[model samples]
Target: MRGPWSSIQSKLVFLIAGISMVTVLVGFSLVTERFAQSLRDSLENDSLSLAQRLVVDSAAYLSLGMAGQARDNLLDKVVLNSPHSLALFDEQGGLFAEIERGGGQIVVDDYRPESAVIWESDWLHIYQPVEDSLDQRIGTLYLKISLSQLSHRMRAFVGVLLVLLLVMLALAYFLARLMQRYISGPILTLADISRQVRDHQNYSLRAPVKSSDEIGVLSQTFNDMLETIEQQQAFRDKVEQSLRIKEERLERAVAELQYMANYDSLTGLPNRALCMDRIELAIRHASRTRTYAGIIYLDLDHFKDVNDSLGHAVGDELLKATAERLSDVLREEDTLARIGGDEFVIITTDFSSSDQIIPLVSKVVERFEQNFTVGRYSVQSTVSLGVCVYPDDGDSVDALMKAADAAMYKAKDVGRNTYAFFEAEMNRMAVWRQQLGSELQHAIDRDELYLVFQPKVALESGQISGAEVLLRWEHPEFGSVSPADFIPVAEHTGLIYRIGLWVLEQACEAVSRWRDVGLEGVTVAVNLSAAQFRQADLVEHIAAILARHNVPPQTLELEITESMLVRDVDQAIRMLKRIKLLGLRVAIDDFGTGFSSLSYLRKFPLDALKIDRSFIMDLGKNRDDTAIALAIISMASSLRLKVVAEGVETPAQWSFLAGHLCDEVQGFLISPGLRESEFISFYKSFSLDEVIASRNV
Candidate 1:
């Protein structure tokens, strides 16, 4: 039966089935969505219209100024027409009329005076005000209709689809059966013989050939294969024995190769690749556990003189001895890797505080103060150590490595025999951020939080195109704090939600003031932190802010990083679309720095892609950076999005981006972030040529 289905003949069946399935799926999706939408629209519209008509129809009866009981009785006109449960309430919310299918709690979010629709499970609940000729509210009309009809129709449609699918499948099966020929019987027989021969190890067996077609050729080939197998059986056993021996040797070689790949050949310590993997794993674990992971980067001072004077052999011995000594000091879980010559890194697997790692750093630094003996040669090698803590200094393995390396160089810079925390300054920063997090609650109250506006220049016109809102903290002790210092702290402490809202309100306030004084068409971009962006109430909050300030949404643009979309693409898309619908422009900031997909880029309702400053900073000077900037511009163009180059400080950067037709450029070259008054002054007195010649604002 499968003879036709098992060969080229089955192609037609598959093609027909696939086409039918795809056509049905596509048609069903389109029709079902449209049908559901129509049903919803019809339900809401009809409910509202009916409620309004009933309100008007009963208004004449209720206007007679009869007793409350008489008005209640008069509202029966409403129940007569309404198929589902309803209640007519007077202006004071007194129940005038009532009808119900099943006893259900009369629930509405709030007593909305205006008309609104609420989807209550399978019921469409619509409420509207009963207005007289003078448009005064006489009463409120509430009506609900069952959505059961929609479900029924959808089920019926799905049933029809199922029947259609079954019919197509049956037709395919029938066609396959009709196409199957007696020729398949011989081929099946040959298959059975071959299977049996293989199962029983009876290679002497042969397939019988009955025709002179392909099947005949297959049968003859099968016979020849069996004969050849039988003759080669002994030789195969001998070959298998040889292969087993070789396999054993290969396994040992593979193990050795694996060891050599990951471990330093001389020191037997984990090499650069394995060290990176270990550090990355530790970083990930620390992030999840909310603890600190540390890297202790050690470099021997003047060890190159040991290499040149004492020779490579001594250096190798010294490295191995150093590795052994370091391994002895560290716990089993900690990694001591010889990533380079005279440069070693010890990764703290897990630590609750930076203090735990500092002891290890000190021990390593102190250990190197002693003399290292290698092959009858004594050498005094003082090691400079740099320590970096996770999350505070950096989050990633590469970042932590670089941070630790920089600290090590710093230690070397300050005379050799000492250790330095790369984030030593960061320790103070951490304190400041922590202080800000706790004190941010009072920032709004103390009137310390203020915003600076950074102007973005349109490359084409060389005039102010937009301004990004930069928040500053003016703590009593600290005169002015950069957003870079406090933003992350706020995010971590969950104060960003409040700070973000404040920022939005402030931005809207600024925009409102500007518009009042005839500074219209200026879009103020405000950055949305990840935590704030993910809030369910962000859209409503923003709408309320815009309304409160009497500022149009078009005047305010929300700048979101690509990371937000990367976390939850679908949710981000929905949120961004909501913002788009609200008439606010959205731009993906630091575009090239994130792992956002190209597919997602189009899905995002984005107005612009702001190329990361790092890429823009070296444009024209660095070929790769220039290429990346150009590529981003081209992609944004192809996607029908505007491209804004950020951190454009140099004339060369400005010119290169202008040449590429970048939509806007923002950086110190245009102007550093300014006070609102200063920005307004600059905005009034600035142009492309003016700023370039003056060097800065």
Candidate 2:
């Protein structure tokens, strides 16, 4: 139904037919022209041959003066051989003889050699001079060859050309029609499909692909585009329907995300992030109004015990109840937030005075006096509260939080269920503690730490038995940092593990050195911190250190505190047994200090019991201190454990401990902790009996 312009078939057929006709006409003309030129060349060659022969024959006749013979030869042999005319003329420009196919004579009035020959439109004329053997110009002969043979051949060529032209035209037309079907067919189909899709918005229609040509590729691409459009249209329809529901869900999702970000998931209270933001806002408000705001940081005491005894399910329920109870006690303007597990912060703004905030902190602490019922369990818990007021304790959120945290620890240090306000000195101490912790990590690498030995002597003879290894640090900035100062810092920061291992390695090496110098049976005792004792690799580490130094375990004694032994009695017993199995002596340092049960004392694998310095410092002056020291000595003797009294600075103290049957004594009364050289000198210079005899004298 498509028109010729629209139909590729019709248009290709017309284009092919017009091109074929023009090609045929041009080919016919070229063939006829070439054939006519060949026939003309043949006629010219034949006329030249006849003219040359006639000239030669006519020369003989002219030399002999026989014109009749020249005429017969030229006419019969030359002109008769060609469909042309022949003429002969003398040197004097007079016509001698002339012959033509029609037997007509050519009239020459004053023929010259230059005008001897002339070509006509239909004839090729040639002129030749007849010469004798003497090379003299005698006479001229001329011929006019006919071009009619060339015309006949051209006519015959045209007849054959027309026939071939018609045949070629038929083939070209058929070829064009076939090409249109194969090449343009797919393109037209694609166009039609596109039109249908554009008019009806139907993306499901696909164009037919019949060949692998460019048009076929175009059809395939159009089909792929339609498929993509169909998928996208279906997706678009689904998206439109879900968009409304997604909008509704989006609002609720935003609210939920915000709540989860700001509030604790378990207690539904503001989290640490929200609390800090509120604290900043509160500080700004207080700064603007020239008022005070208090930040009370509270942590529940013994909460871990509840979780450990019962399941975490009970712990969760308990935390929820605690949150509710704390919320009930807060004023409408006050805020309570859970920063972490069992730790809460309360911000009280709009307070006129510091005293007004005390009742709030007190109420929060008093609420824990009653037991909490969670599930089927009733748990008793207490809280330690640290309060820091704005413009007094700190001006910034981080500073205030740290100050309050320090104060809370101070409250726990004094007793649980108590509240303490942050003071300026507390901040200074916290900063100092942090600095000491930082410096302690590099103490060993800096070579600023060293060990001094304090000799333990037999009380009966006053002879040196062994030495205790004491850690000391000389800071480049602080001059001399006390063990009292940096030891706790190291312990708090978990640096004690590394420091303790270093001490053990050094002590073992020192003992090995002493033994190499003939100091037999010289044992070195190294104190182990609570943190060091809890390491899973403690036994292996100590064993490696001892083996590395080639020191026997008996010469390397490990001294642990009473508190370490009682922390977990069963685990402590296992560790002690392992230490004993290695042939290393174990001692309980600072006895009669930790609030441990006396019944478990016998279960510890110990070689000695060192009386705490606190008990020994007050000996002979305080009956309670005297009785405790005596009780330790008696218990150690009964248990067959060596008794050592520490910190015996005065004669009376040493004499009292010796008289009470204390087996070993270590303190300043003998000599302060000595450097390695000093200890070696002291060891060679004095014996137990000699020192005792000198003291008595």
TM-score of structure candidate 1:
0.41
Q: Where does candidate 1 have its weakest 10-residue lDDT segment? A: 74-83
Candidate 1 runs further than 4 Å off = 1-430
Model 2: what TM-score?
0.59
Model 2, global lDDT:
0.82
Q: Whose TM-score is greatest here?
A: 2
lDDT of 2 by residue, 23-75 (tens): 77787777677777677667766667777877777898887878888888875
**On residues 146-208, what C-alpha lDDT tens digit does candidate 1 reach at each position?**
777667877887788778767866775665545444456666688788789869988878877
Cα displacement (Å) at residue 468, model 1: 0.7
Task: Report the lDDT of model 2 for residue 221.
Answer: 85
Which residue pairs clash within candidate 1? none
Error of 1 at 178 (Å): 99
